[model samples]
Target: MTDDKSTIGQLPDFDTLANSLIEEGVLTVAPSELHGMLSGQLAAGARFDPDTLLRVVAELMDLDILNGENIKLILLELYQTTLAQLQSTEFSLQLLMPDDVHQLEQRADALGGWCSGFLSGFGLYAARHAKLSEEVTETLHDLAQIAQIAAESEAAGDEDEADLMEVYEYVRMAALLVFTECNPEPDDTDEKQPLLH
Candidate 1:
């Protein structure tokens, strides 16, 4: 457990940005969902290439949303924050999501979108598809199940709150485990610096 928290404090409001994106007809997936996808890729050992990520996001948006300076800056901050947090040695990663002010059902649905984005990002990585490790396979399956979460019209009671909390924790811990499993820390002893004559 790292003492570090996400640079979320320094970023713009999540729901505001998401709404802006929606109004602009930029993307179907929200910013939090997009972050989920990026985090998944980083966990799989992808480099923190902001340009490439922006390009991927633009592709996903169907139209370039970079024309707006605020949007561009927000995205840059998001990528930077996610990279910093996930790269922490203490497995300190948190999902970028709407605040608790939102309804539980809405939050759960957003999480489902986040999971769907995560699976999409995983699919983009050839390594994920090529391997057959049982643990990783099972993790992927679990994520897939969450991705299909549907919203309910009825108000959630105490049980739903408990279930949502469990799911949230599971998703958070699952991401950490997947990241650790895929990208083990490099052994310092294996490095051999070249001797200068």
Candidate 2:
């Protein structure tokens, strides 16, 4: 857990990592999108071991670009951290996304991709295995709608910035809600105390 947390905190620059994946011809989706997919799957109860996780990520990205040992290790650690974070008692939606310095249109595009990936991941299990509540269904619908958003370079005004911020927060909260609904906290059952011998 510590390793996972530390790695997450000290992650390499998003652009650098993304460029590496692109250079390797392996990154089909943006970093945020990839992480969203992984998180959605885990939250929906997909149990994948480290190797399996790596394989799935590679497939999602379109190839096994982890030809290098360091990349492989880093990705594995990220997967572990993501899984742990999803299952955490202090679970929160902390997307490994690009910084806010990017333009509004670019951010919107990235968000759309992330939403698309999230829906894909959630549907993987929710469609077949689990029974979704009405709320979850609605959330999924909302996300599906969001996935269709396109880049709109209107202006660099405060209102637009504020709206973008709101959207970002909405996505974050909506994801956390979905995760909570899918992975409910364990009920406290302590009717009988442990016997002290």
Candidate 3:
């Protein structure tokens, strides 16, 4: 198995994944939202298995099986890259979204979609847990609100751009917070021992 840290700096970028999806005619979910859904599942302690991940994506996105192989490769890479970023000690998580060249409203819309996907995936698994910490509960509530955000009717000015970045940063950190809380690292010293004769 590859070390999670080894995969840290090698994540596939948003445009590349997005373009590939478009070329393949899979338009059901944006790359950002797909990444968010995977992140949410990982945060909720879902095990990493390529087939299972592909199945979940298909079900969630209403994807057709005939187009599965190529999409499966993309999804697997995304899953590994996301899992690695989450497990890294350096706090290197990055949300998948378009570059700054894109208009603020478009990016904001993607961010909202990402939050929606995260909530969907998180809610699907988080229900198994009897309770969540107060912090996590509040964070989920905040994410839900973010998911509903719509950009202003007027042209976005500098202030709107700055505000959008602030919201983006909050959502990024919120994802990390959820992951950290739900998937605490196991203690090395707590490893199980073999039974003695």
| Candidate that would win on lDDT | 3
lDDT of 2 by residue, 63-115 (tens): 84457655566676556666555556564446666777887777777777778
Clash count, candidate 3? 0
Query: What ranking emerges by TM-score with the best candidate at the front?
Result: 3, 2, 1
Per-residue error (Å), model 3, residue 161: 1.6
Q: What are the Cα lDDT values of the candidates?
A: 0.68, 0.67, 0.76
Candidate 1 lDDT trough over 10 residues, lowest sum: 188-197
Candidate 3 residue spans exceeding 4 A from truth: 1-7, 66-70, 150-154, 187-197
Candidate 3, residue 157: Cα displacement in angstroms equals: 1.7
Question: Candidate 1, after superposition: displacement of residue 14 in Å?
Answer: 1.6
What is candidate 1's lDDT per residue for 1-197, written digit by digit as tens? 12354333343578877966876676677876787787777666665455665666677678754566666667777766675666566555677777888887788877887777777766666354456468877887898888676333336778887888788778877777777676667565222221111
User: What is the C-alpha local distance difference test score of candidate 3?
Assistant: 0.76
Any runs in candidate 1 off by more than 4 Å, and if so which?
1-12, 150-155, 186-197
**Alpha carbon lDDT at 156, candidate 1:** 78
Instruction: Kindly list the per-residue Cα lDDT of model 3 for residues 83-184, writing each as its tens digit.
Output: 778877878888888889998788888888888888887877786567889998999899989888743323578998888889988998899899888877
Question: Candidate 1: deviation at residue 167, Å?
Answer: 0.7
